[model samples]
Target: MDTRCNDITTRNKNEALCNACLIPIKENMRFYKCTYECNFVLHEWCTRLTTELKDYKIERDQLRHFSHRHPLTLVYLQQPNHNADDEDEEEKEKEKEEDFVEEDHHGGQCEMCNKEIWSFHLCYYYCKSCNYSLHKFCAELPMTQQNHPSHPSHILTLSNLVQSRNNFYFRSTDGTWKCSLCNLMWKNIYNYHCSICNFNMDIICATMSEQKINHPSHPHRLERMSGPIVSGCLACGNKHEGEFFQCTNCPTFRINLDCALLPTKLLIQNHTNGTYTHSHPLTLAYSYPHSEIISKYYPFCRVCDGKFYSHLWIYKCDKCRYYVHVDCATSKREPFMSIFLHESLGKTFKNYKEDEHPNLLHCPFPDEDDNLLKHHMSNQMEFISKQHDGEMLNHPSHQHPLIFFNEQTSVDKKMVSLHDPMKRIQLLCDGCVKPITTVPFYMCCQYVDEQCCFVLHEWCAKLPSQVQDYAGHPEHPLSLLPKIPGKFFGVFKCSICELQSNGFVYGCITCEFYVDINCAFIPKEITHDAHPDHLLLRVKPSTNLSKRYCKACQYSVRYSELVFHCPSCDFYIHVQCALLLPKLIKHKCDKHPLSLRYEPVENHISQYFCEICEDEFDPWEWFYHCTTCAQSMHAACGPLILQCEQATYAYDQQSVYRFLNVKFGGTLEIKGHSHRLAFVQGLERDGKCSECDTKLQYEMIFKCLECEFALDYKCASSFVS
Candidate 1:
């Protein structure tokens, strides 16, 4: 695929040559040229990994020494080519044996060192399938902490267990964020770190035995520690689960793995000003401005309102005290990893028309022409909605800039704002007239005048201009655009969110890493009421990631949304699950009060059910319960409350409201049958809902009193909505 139709094999920069794997040929990596007129070219490794050479891939990756009693197992430098015709038993067995998977190290923790290995090159023996890991370069760390630059007064010592497992409260950020050196976040990397000075390091840095480190945390020498640690780390309150470094002077003081390994200096770019602000880059500082400092104190991270702690690595200006978090600095909205484009939108280069692109709208950025952008946007009152009401109002679909709707009718039937309406309408999103599933949508006459009656997902309005690393595609960045411009309005699907959209998309102009607005900037960690005790992390499995469901909602958001997972408990929650929800709520039904409760996962006593919705809910899911009525309802059924006795919240009343799905009731009119429907708890084994003709198992169904008419909650709810 070179620009020149030549059989040249020399390392060249201008030519994009390699064709076997379709990557542009670059210098240094050797490639072979074709002797024939077809002018085909391929990288040397690609040539060996081709489909025809599939059987030889394992042999190439693995090497047996001359005196080898056992074969040295090795993984591929990249994904090895697969054989499509490998239906034979031998190939199947080989596939099962290899399981060749490359793990994404976004938030994995090394069990041995208790430090995250963000880069694979940093660790030699970390396994993704299990928590087992050992840095090949550094086996057991060396002892004797003395003469370090960061600490110089006294010698550091080794200890075991930063804190006992029994006292694992007030957890440290040991495995949560990355090292002070790498600036990457890791959930678990294990090591004693620096015995004194409260310093932490990952396994890779521990291998550098020659350097005795000093840190500002203490006035002493800190060294690499060996053996199991048992005390709690002073820097972070959490008890050490793996290893720790202790201060020889202050025997009680300890530091975990993440702090000891921070780098002394970094030549990082100053993104805020786009310059190298100082002669020296940011320096690692252990003693930083504490929050208690007076006005003229140390610099704090603007991204996260936090001060620089010794155990935590914070970037600061070498010339000044300016500081920031590593993540907030490196994570600029630049696309680097993009994979979907290559596989999905292949003909984009052929079909793309720059001038006719839909994203290139008549509108410019708000910053460029604020007045014009506002004027261009239609300004009209909602059907009954008003912005910034005093009732702490929120739309069912949109969260921000919320309003209250007052739908009323005058004698002429023109329109008027009513303070309270007895019955609520089914809330619908203007984007599509579907009942709003996610909460806090836009309503009122303001949106009505805009032609979009009520409801708009907040993400649909406030989309980020760009996004960085998605689950895969770590090569190029993607851009958010308003779909492909012009006549070709082909249906498009977001790889992350898995929702089909013919609208705006976040796409890499260079590649096809595309996702919908809802999938952008998903939080990596979440503190949830669903799982009250521990923080849930976002884990994107490399394979079969499409099928994992959230434990709370008992659903998955395809590839778009991230899942908050608790590795210890093996619990999973959707990104939506992270949203702050109330504990108590009021519903229109038997109205004493209801408190939110998580249905126990394993309950053999009796299956709990939500009375209002009549939908079988996951016992592990959150629902509202009224002790008085001895009944439960869904938070989705109404706005939740902070406490049972607190003020009533009426699902943040809206003009277009979602109706509660009441399945089995006394008497319901049958459209096709001349009979009143009656609630039925049991019937023959083959009993089904007459409306949708689906089996009603272990749940109540609305059946005609005198005929075969019936309805299940799922179908019946749609009619009511």
Candidate 2:
């Protein structure tokens, strides 16, 4: 026999070789022959032997039945009887009927019995000789199972539980026996049992095969249990009780029988390499930077890119990288996963149109006729021309016929006017209405005479020399003063106008008054209510005893001696007072309560008032008031008051009276009364006034012929100046 492909080896020549048992074949023997080696053959029984049988050294004779303590033997063929009655048709019919009845009673072929039977019946197959049988399906089962390496003793067995105990059962607190696999409890009776181990499985667990099974909750097949029941169910975190599928090598790991068969890898929409960038992992049980611990741990699923609020998570990435919540990343469409473009790529360059370009010259070449350049030059030249024109008029007085002359020709005697040869000469400028200096004088041809020694600028002689109402002094008619002074001259003073004569001066010859060309046309009726007591008087300095301070503002007079003064009250004022315009005025003490009132009083204190907000008072106080209503105020309240009433008023007689009545504790004698009034010291015993509760320092004592009354300084000075 050839031993190369045979399980059993033998040395022989011309022997019909057994391929499996490796023995010489006999003429009447039953054996299996290999197609590749026609001479090779195997015994029929040897080919049917189980793989476990090979390890036991048993003799060929022992294969009959001694190992099983039974009379079982291998039979080659059964002997036949030849009798006429044995082939009876009726008897054969009866036998066939009996076989049919038996098959019907046993349902379909019993898997353990390995025989054909009827269908739709419940009965176990049994052997008549030894009473050993199995269900047809079980009879065909292999001796050992695959994928269940840990449990070697698993075997097929018939379930014989009572009808009441056959249902699914689980343990409960009601003192009942239960089946852990089916989750149903039984209260009354014992039923089917396991012969080995303390674990008593239900009919369901015993019959369930080790194969993938479908469950409604998961989208995968669930495998059967092969080892100890897991304590934690990976799907729900509850204590696992029933049979479950778990990998022993993975600590504390157990998946639902359903989850065990799911595809290991998933392709998620916004995840890469089974991880979501949106959900970076931190250390398990790690504290947050602010010392907060996440109570319910969850990880973002890469597959769905959504947060899975579960405690079991896989964290094996570097710490520096950021991870977004899977749900957040998915909703954002994973914009960070864009393909990077190289900087050198022309596609990255942006193109801009000429109109959109920020460069000054998009065309690169210079064009003299460019519209922008022409516009710029035109604007610049226009500005320069205006500046030059402004410079042409240095002084308003010189605007007539001014001419630049060299100093050499300035002292020419011919430039002197003949009308006033001995009179002091005064020069006039054609340009800015100002007097010309010792430069050469341009004379009018008509006025120039060598022997007459008279000369004047032609333009200066023709220019207008008189003006009507100028600024605030309007009543007086103004005329130009002659260039040469008359016989009586001590610095040419205009007696009526009260202004020093300079260059061409306007004068009211009827009043013997003169004013500079600028002040000649002052307006007579100023719109200011501050000076409403009397019309603003434009007059030069005079010996009038009443003209003291400026009537408008009460400021001391200096250069412009011709000022506005009120003849009625002997008040003088500056012209600028009439022009003051303030937005809002306030006082320090009563900011919100008081406002300026501008109205003329019959006996005005100091002249001038804020007319818009008609407030009148001593001009010494800063005057400002609202222009809406009638309210008088003091400038001292500006520090305290923020808002006030509208109207303004000029200083009234009451203010002047108040000022005069203020006492400095000095002795005062009434002009008409004969007796002298003296300030007497008050009692120093901290006695307060009955009326005002103020500590009185000095009391006034009035000594009269019939009566005497002691009064405070305030009361004593009230009746006197």
Candidate 3:
């Protein structure tokens, strides 16, 4: 056997193989050749490694690895002494096994292959600064190589730099490199790269010394096959011509190079499901178990809400059951998003709980202080079961005292018993005019015809008397009112949404600026799915109406309306469009949910048409599509097109207020009107408004159900607002 040479760092400039590490020794690489006629070559760095020798005494206990910023410390456990008694030796062996289990629990994943450093051999390199770890064999990898097999023309240097990319290199959203050889994205690890040629090979791909690989996605070892194979990849469920790997045991189970090298674990941040954002680590699932499949519906991707093919792989949280598409796991806009949101939002919402009801911030009787309130209530109104009947309140909204009920038992015994027991009646909240389905609510004690006259949700009942720091109207505090305070018609135009509402309003008495209940909870800044790169600012309608069209529906956003605008990107979305147009939804036409697409599908030259209406539509605008079925539809044609339907209130039999899906000639029943109003587009021949006396040309109006009491949408705000 030849002894390894030391103190020999000169470049060999020879095309040969490193006999120690088995990597190619290309031109300009440092290597040693045998002085004898026998051809034997070794890399200069190979001199420091103990070649295939177990239990060899290491000269250095620590090594500085390029993958990590800190020095890596070697953890080694020695064999127990055999001189002990048999019983003692058995006990020591058991203790050693327990220690190994403990080490496995505390161990970190190796940065190179994303596998746990099991310490089975009781030897591994670990960084104390960060939990980055590496196997002993992985530590001997060459830092740089000239004329690598992946890119033989130029030298490949080991780097973790994501920004060093040439024009040919398309950088992924998550700041990871798409390895040139494997075509899989990787991050936070060293990769051999040539910036000049835009070539990159991840550490795992660079170290492949065998044609066979044991992939976590399969139980069998897979052998690489050179091809333009027509078979589909089981990981992504996409069929394309590509070099693939086939299972040695099962030929049918094949994975393309891209899917075979996918990262086993992925950590995503600022990923959104509707308006909710989450940052959780997702584990790559080989496949969804058969038990999890429901009614032939596979797991839905939380980001897009579309059901991906069941056979395809996905990244999911076992606990949350939160599934994400394999391709949608990363975001190229995340780095730009943080900086934009910080500068745009200006204030952090960390203090405010995103899931909490807005009215909970000003709850007069909080759950935490229930006992204390009960103590003080000793001299006050009588109390019932804490779980069911609650303390009574002399609410200002009703003349009679209101009794609180938290559970179905109390509602049944106290209120339901008064009505027909066999009949099922839906209770509508008097505050927001919405159905009171669940929870703590207050019902009027004084009954009219054996029925409670009033009802309010516990949160709705505790609405703050005044919003002192409302983001919409900073000039003055908005006072909560049953209706728009000064309007004789009991309706007011919501300054935020530019819609009319007669329900609850938070209004500025001085400025006459009012926001409906739904609009009142709108955050000052929001991170919408449409514009993930920046936070959308809540901007008061600009006076300039020429460019006030919404990017979503392409409808005109009137100057009097408020919109969520991205000043940096010139993106403006209607408040209703932003809140109501969900990222994913199930339509009647398709069994699977459709995902919203921001732009036209690339390279699709065919004319775009709605799957529902079967009418041609603009492809450049936002639309919903199902990738599995290749179906597309317009937003207006979808079922959730009633985006502006905020609430429904029934004042009486003849007078009801609700958002109607009114078109050019539709009809609706309003709060103040006794009969339904007919929707009509105002014509040049249209007469003046009954109230405002303004000409009704170039506008939408609701004509009186009985007579020519024509009212424009602006004047209609009085009755509906």
Best by lDDT: 3
Best by TM-score: 3
Query: What are the candidates' C-alpha RMSDs?
Result: 30.6, 40.1, 19.3
Rank order by lDDT, top first? 3, 1, 2
Clash number for each model? 76, 101, 7
Which residue pairs show backbone clashes in model 3? 173-331, 173-332, 492-721, 500-721, 501-720, 501-721, 502-721
The lDDT for every candidate, in the order shown, is 0.42, 0.35, 0.57
Of the two candidates 1 and 2, the one with more favorable TM-score, higher being better, is: 1
lDDT of 2 by residue, 177-225 (tens): 5554554664532223322332344433444553333432334454556
TM-score of 3: 0.34
Error of model 3, residue 443, in angstroms: 3.7
lDDT of 1 by residue, 1-721 (tens): 3223345554545364443334567766677775544334566665444423313323533422111123333332223445668488788757744653223233344344554443323333333344344333322233223554434453422222222233221135463534433444445434323322345444444344432344457787555455445555554333444445666566666776544544444544434343223333555555545552233233345333334554554566533434555433432211332321121100111222444433222211111111111221223224123443563345433334434322324213544322111123234333322234333444543443544334443333333456677554457666767554331222255565343444455677567667554455444554445444354567765445445556445554354345566665445665433432244444556556466555432112244555644654444445567766667655554431111221222333211111211112234564556776665342444278766677664334556666566677455544444
Error of 3 at 114 (Å): 45
Model 3: per-residue lDDT, tens digit, 342-383? 222111233335454332212111211121112222333322
Q: Report model 1's TM-score to 2 decimal places.
A: 0.28
Runs of candidate 3 exceeding 4 Å displacement: 1-389, 409-428, 433-435, 445-453, 486-489, 541-545, 556-561, 580-721
